[model samples]
Target chain A: MIFLKFLLYVWMVLVLLGAFFYAPLAKGLGEYTRVMYFHVPMAWITTLTFLIGAIYSILYLRKKDIRYDYYSETANQLGLLFALLATITGSIWAKMSWGAFWNWDPRETSIFILLLIYAAYFALRSAIEQQDRKAALSAVYDILAFVTVPFFIFIVPRIYSSLHPDPLINTQGKVTMNGKMQLVFFNSLLAFTMVYFWMLKNKLEVIKLKMKLKQLES
Target chain B: MIKAYYIFRKDLLQEFKTRFAMNAILLFAVVTLSAVSFAIGTFTARQEVLSALLWIILFFSSMSGLSHIFVKEEEAKTADTLKLVASASAIFLGKFLFNIVLLFLLEIIVVPLFIALMNFNVQNYLLLFFTLFIGSFGLAGGGTMVAAIISKSGAKGALFTVLSFPILLPVLVSGISATKIASQEQGWMTAYSELQTLFAFSVVIITASILLFDFVWNE
Candidate 1:
């Protein structure tokens, strides 16, 4: 685990360096293209974490396991964090490229909706006082929220011609990135996903420890 | 399904008797419509803005009272009785249908008043009707399920809108776009994709709600 953590550290550092120095800047975008390496991966991790969160929520519902609730809750909170990062990073990039922090672009609107959906998740969790009831209701909510995600991320954004950059895999069915960019980009995705899972694992451990301490006190 | 219908009828009968949900939503719709038309008097707002305004009125009006289908059951302590009598899915379906009827009633009154008051011109009545109809299904589907979820929580009123808004956004977006097209175009083909989106959204939301209702209803 320690070795894996060390590797993650090196991998992220190398990806950052490659994003700046190794990857060739693209036409028109120049230095701003580097934001894609971090921003895109953060967005990818946001979706990935939310997907995992929903999956575990289904598991919790089926198995009636408190541990699964912990997993689902932790994954969801991390997903929200990464989503916030993705939005802030994308906003900075937007300000640079579009001359404003927000343009109400299709992509921006969808992510903002995702933020609201998960924020509602937390609000729902906070409102329910009982443990089991909170877990059950929230798991159901997570699943319902996940069902709408595809519409927001995939469908709604595509319904309008967007100010956001063409996706990595554009409508023309082309991978826009060249070789070194792809290498760095994929590595960044891998690094961030690894970091998310690592954080999820540690957070779950802390949750378990806290539960144990609560049980002892009781 | 029969039980579901019975549940729907029971709620509808109660609704007609008390008229709580109907009155709340109708009052909201009328007030909002009058305020909007009074504000934009004789301005001849653009088709796009008018279409968006219609949906905004419908959305907020539904938000005012749609959650009552579940919140009422919980508050009156009839939720437990309903649970004993009906399966979770049946209860959900019944409430879903009741909410749909309530939404339609709100639309019947508001849409006409909105048009008359704002002088809104809808070129394709069929397209506009289909958009509003399917959009109401989406709203009630999402609204019923969310109301069930939040009815279990301590804060019901505020949480219902917060929870349902994001879920219902696709419906609103597609509905507004379709209404915009309906205002300018003469055929359904022009707004084909928007109608398809509204249809798909309603199907997805309702199906997911039914499948997940067991958890929220029982627990």
Candidate 2:
């Protein structure tokens, strides 16, 4: 528990430092570049969360364990939050750079669509009253939707010339980042991943507690 | 395969009898076209604009087709019965085929009306049809899956569009791009590759939905 608390503190400090320096860095590089620190991290975390959600979904399907379902649900909820943040930050960047908050560019539009798809997943879960069916159905949807995420994020955008920049983390040695920028970029990535795991742990614990309470009452 | 065909035929026959899906989709298409045309006011009207308008009409019309799929089943309390008799894959295939046919019918009506209203001409009718056909397949496949999921929700009609449009973006972009190329009278060899991409998309989505349907439905 102490170790977890220490990790949480470290994550919080990293996030604050990243957020603080992101603006000055943007002003230094260009207004559009500021989005790289925050928006890109959010986008990366969203993908990471979705992948983690998909893994838990598979485990839930295989084991039919309520705990795995809780984990999957927590990851999905957090993924949606990060996806929304990515969209908002991207939109703000677009307004500054492209002079429009929402252009129907392939990347922008595809991410927006991704957000909607996951939001529907949650909506579907809430609408169903049966617990077993909700977990099974949502698990299936999560896996299937995660499969399509690559098509939307990578393939669809590549098919068209997008205003959004190409993958900064590329195969050919990190897409040419300077030392200071790399420090900030890699640190933010690590910080966000830690925060995501922290949130997932807390959320899953809460879900398990609720289930225990319900069983006790019954 | 025969069971799938039977289910598909039954859906088509029932739809023909009631005209619920067809009428809703056609009316929605017409209204959307009229609204967009009115908004554009003919000053900035061009073939590109007209093509986009036709696609928007088809996109919105698809939502109606999607909603009608399970709404009709739910209204009659026949969804449970259908589920017991037919596998989820069969039901998905049936609904997907029905959506494709419905969208095709709407396209037949709306595309010409759009051309007349917007003064657009098709330079390559065959290529345009191929593009539209493949694009509609993707839309119907993904849309039917989403519709099934959303059907369990309270506000299904609204939920269908909200869930589908984003998931449908890849096909929409490819469809619009293919249509533009076809409209330019491009050679078959040139358009063939893009057509292949769209076909691959449709196939993958349809298969994925089929494999995943039981989980969604059983749940």
- Local error of candidate 2 at residue B44 (angstroms): 6.1
Interface quality of candidate 2 as DockQ: 0.43
What lDDT is reached at residue B132 by model 2? 89
RMSD for each model, in Å, please? 1.4, 3.3
What local lDDT score does residue A210 receive in model 1, on the 0 to 100 scale?
A: 93
Clashes (N, CA, C under 3 Å) per candidate: 0, 0
For each candidate in turn, the interface RMSD (Å) is: 0.7, 2.5
Chain A only TM-scores, each candidate in turn: 0.94, 0.88
Q: What is the TM-score of chain B alone in each candidate?
A: 0.98, 0.92
Tens digits of per-residue lDDT for model 2 on B1-219? 677788899998998898888888899899888888788886756666667667878898888776788777877888898988888788888788878888888889998888788767788888888888888898888888887777665556666776677667677777877777767675787666568768877888888888878767766
Q: Kindly state the number of residue pairs that clash in model 2.
A: 0
After superposition, the stretches of candidate 2 with alpha carbons farther than 4 Å from their true spots are A7-35, A91-104, A169-174, B38-44, B185-197
For candidate 2, lDDT tens digit of each residue in A105-168?
9888788878888887887688767777778877877776776777788777767778876676
Candidate 1 stretches with Cα past 4 Å from truth are: A169-173
